[model samples]
Target: MIRRAMVLAAGRGTRLAPLTDTTPKPLLPVAGRPLLEHILEFLHAGGIREVVINLHHLGHAIEERLGDGRRFGLRIQYSWEDPILDTGGGIKRAEPLLGGEPFVVVNGDSLLELHLEDVVAFHRARGALATMVVRPDPEAARYGLIELDAEDRVRRVVGLPPGVEGTFRGFMFPGLHVFEPDIFGWMEPDAAYSVIRTTYVKLLAAGMSVYGFLTPARWVNIDTPRALAAADLTLRTAPFRF
Candidate 1:
């Protein structure tokens, strides 16, 4: 089972603007509590015992608020980035803490109601190099499309080459991924980059086993003021069970 995970919390959250000027995106309040707290609770409920959160952009406040993560039932560690690496770089930087095993990566700015055990199970069963939690969204093209074949294998990402002309479904990544340790082989060391735009695209080009797991779970990406308000209303009216 995948017990270790990384939370990409270092981004400046430029879209949120003035609100993020004083507070990190992950710490922004969604319902009654900080957004990161909800993410931690969800991770804990999903059976993640150890977590490594990459920090930058007023990161100390996050450290002071979360600390060892004991209250959240997690053993938390921090990876301090000098220039604030992007998603791929952040995970690569935290490799030492993640250990040599399959692990999960979550985008710190989004809220998802998923039973992670199911996602991990699907990943292991498919023997995929990586499995992304994708959801059908009408605005998927705006988020960069991830096209999945009938078998749920990711045939194309961001409209990269080797295009499929036949029937296929397009989905959007909801910031949840299960990856094997070997995925590091496809990434450069200490370079800032997006995993989707860089690593996943390369994996698809090389005919690697990248799969997409479609989920029915409700999700919200809290990046802009509009999104933040939507998330707050969603949680207040229909809170997640797990």
Candidate 2:
């Protein structure tokens, strides 16, 4: 069972400048509550007992607000970054806390209505090295894209080839995944690596089963002010609650 998770909150929200100036993007309020709080609540409700959150820019504020996991009914651990190790490094740093088991990793800034239990079950069922929660979209080029085979195993990443076309319908990653402990073996030690650029792509090259779970639910990547505002508005009117 995937009972632990890691929230990647270490990035400097360069795009969301003015708002991120005072508060980190993860702490930014969405629907009256901080985005990270909603993620914690979701994990707690999903029966996850432990969570490790990595913080870098304006991290003290997050540490002050969420000192421990007890307040949210979960054990909260902080992976304090000194030089702002990127996504891959951050996850590598927290692997000790995550232990030798497969765990869930979510971007603390992005908000999505994830079926945590269902996704976990699916991850174990498929026996993938990593299972990405992705959605089919026409605007696939704007973001990192995943190409899945007939069995839904991620065959190749979309961007590496210069003139890649829609061989298979591409999907935008929702910033959430279930990863096995072996996934870290593909990463280089002490280097700034992205799960997509370095790890996931390597898994595909090694012929590992990397699946994509297409979610029909709503997902928003809150990077810019306009996107954040739209997400807030959507969450308000949406029938489902995160």
Candidate 3:
């Protein structure tokens, strides 16, 4: 029953700077369309009718392009960030629009063909306060990692851990999640925070039910110029179009 969603687009794309100097990362074109547009289309196709996108850097251009989401058949709203709150803060700012239930959060920059319907069902079935979409890979060190227990529940976030064996639990977060409204109880409204550095790890330590949905397919997370180029080629051959 997760009909509402939030797309985190408020980040100052410092990594993709220069280009991001003029255009916001979410509005950066991929395959001739803004990356956020593809994300919205994916949500629309997955039965999500309402979406709120938080914008910070060069946010106005994005608002102008996707205004009210009419062109895409979605009821879009903007959570304009003046001071540019980080992930948790941005989500908290949009909580009113997200309503009283669990909603999907998709990173505006990453490109992934996720099964939104299935992920929503999984989140509800597990009753997790939050559910993260992860992929198994040896490159977990390059990107932050997630460790899943025997039951597929997230046991720990593996970046800079004290000690760990082989890359057996090699999983990287894909920047997408399903979150219940009450999860905000763990956040501080006045402070900015990252879900990865603060919330997800905090959830794991508190024994909160945080789970990971390991996709059995290939996924792409575009960040650098080279990564973006590769994602464009991959999306061209992807079996399913989001």
Candidate 4:
């Protein structure tokens, strides 16, 4: 079972600026609780006992609030990034802390209502190297879409995959994934790059088992102030499912 997870919390949250000027975006309040706290609570219920949260841009606030994570029933560890290492680099740096097994990775600012165990089970059953949690975004332009073949294998991500038939499938990546430790072999250590552009896209082109597990529930990406406000209102009404 995948009991370890990583939260990509190193971002500066420039999109949600000013408020993030004093607090890390993940630490921002959602329904009276910090977003990260809600995520941790969900992770705990999902059977994840250990978690790694990468920090930067007012990282101290997160460190101070979460502490060693005993209060949250988690063994929390921090990966401090001096000059915020983008998604790929952040995960690469935290490789040691994540151990040598497959693990879950979620964006700290995301609020997803889905079954984590099911996602892990799907990953194991398919023997997939990496699996992303995606949702149908018919307007594919803004978020870029990931297309899957009949076998549910990702045939294309944004652009076309090598030697594929006519038009490929497409869907939006919603900031959640199950990744095997071997997936890190595709990333560059200590360099800033996007996991999507650098790894997923490349792996798909090379015919790897990089697949997408579609979610039937709504996902909240708390990026802008308006988005955060909407998420806060939503969370107040509907309880998280994970």
Candidate 5:
């Protein structure tokens, strides 16, 4: 079982503006609890005992609120990025804490309700370099399209439509992933980079083992103020069904 995980909480929540100016995105409240708390609840239930959260914009607030993480049933560590390294760089910085094994990663801003154990199993069963958690999003065109083959291995990712219909369908990634320790070898240590633009895309181009685990679970990205509002309503009415 994977005991360690990474929470990508470092991004400057520029889309949320003045609200995020004073608060980190992960600390924003959803359904009366801090967003990070919800993530911790999920992680704890998923059997993750330790987590490393990457910090950047308004990071102090996160540290102040979640300091030590004992109260949340997990041993928490922080990876401070001086210049706010992107996704790839952030993960690379926390390599020492994540340990030498396959680990789970979740986007702190997104509320994800999936079978966490199954995701880990699926990743290892296929021996994939990286396994992305994806869901059906009608607005897939609005985000990077995750194209899959008949076997559900992520074959290609594109910003524009393929313009040709095939056995593949596009979906939106809900900020959840599983990765092997060796996946770091493809990255440049301490260099600012995007896992999407720099790593995953390159791996796919090289025909490496990048797969997608499709889940029908409820997942919402409280990215913008409007999204947060909608998520609050949805969450309050139904609660996360994990």
Candidate 6:
């Protein structure tokens, strides 16, 4: 069982400005509680006992708010990045805390309703090096496409492995991923990089075992004021069943 997970909460969230000027995106409230609180609760409910959150950009506020995560029924640790590391670098920085198992990673700014156990099962069944939770979206191309073959193997990530012609499906990644520790071998420590544009793209190009787990679960990315309000209203109307 995957017992550890990482929540990437270090971004500056420039898009949600004015509000984010004083408050970190993760600390922004959604449905009467801090957004990070909801994320931590979701992880705890999904059976994650230990979580490592990488912090920057008003990071002290996050540390002050979340403390040690005991209140959330989980052991929480923070990876302090002096110079904000992007997704890939942030995960690389937290490598020591993640341990030697396949673990989960979630975006701090998004709300997704999924059973972590189901994602784990799918990941293990295929022995994939990494598994991404994806959903069909007509505007997926706008977000950058992750193409999958009939077997659900990721064939292209943001358009790599070029010149392959096939009837594959394209989907959008909602920022939930299951990754084997071996993924670190492909990254340079302390360097800022994006996991999607750098790591996953290279992995797919090398024909690595990267798969996409299609989900019909509800998801919301709270990157803008409108999105934040929508998420709050949605949660108030229909709470997550999970």
Model 4, 130-189: lDDT tens digits are 998878876755887778776778777767545666555677888888999998888889
lDDT of 2 by residue, 1-242 (tens): 67899999999999999888899999988777788888888787667888999999999999999988788998889998888779888899887788688899999888677668888888889988899988877787688777776677776676643343345757888788999888778777666778787787677767788898887777766799998898778767772354
Model 6 ranges off by over 4 Å: none
Clash number by candidate, in order: 0, 0, 0, 2, 0, 0
- lDDT tens digits by residue: candidate 3, 1-242: 67888999887888887888999888877777778888888898788889999988888998999999888889999998878889988888887788687799989988567668888899889988999988877787678778876678877776533343333365888788999888888877767878777877677667788889888556665588887777767766663465
Query: Which is better, 5 or 6, measured by TM-score?
Result: 6
Give per-residue CA lDDT, model 6, range 1-242, as digits (tens): 78899999999999999899999999999989888888888888888999999999999999999889899998999999989889999999999998588899999999789888899999999999999999988889988898999999999888876776788899999989999999999888989999999998888878899999999899987889999999999888988755
All candidates' TM-scores?
Answer: 0.97, 0.93, 0.92, 0.95, 0.94, 0.97
Clash pairs (backbone) in predicted model 5: none
The lDDT values for all models are 0.90, 0.82, 0.81, 0.87, 0.86, 0.91
lDDT of 5 by residue, 1-242 (tens): 88889999999999998899898999999889788898998888888999999998989899999999999889999999989889988999898988588888888899787768889899889999999998888987677888888898887776422243457878888888899988888878978988877788778767789899998889777799999998888888988855
lDDT of 4 at 212: 80
Q: Score residue 109 of candidate 3 by CA lDDT.
A: 88
Give residue 55's error in model 1 in angstroms: 0.7
Q: Considering TM-score, where higher is better, how would the candidates rank from best to worst?
A: 6, 1, 4, 5, 2, 3
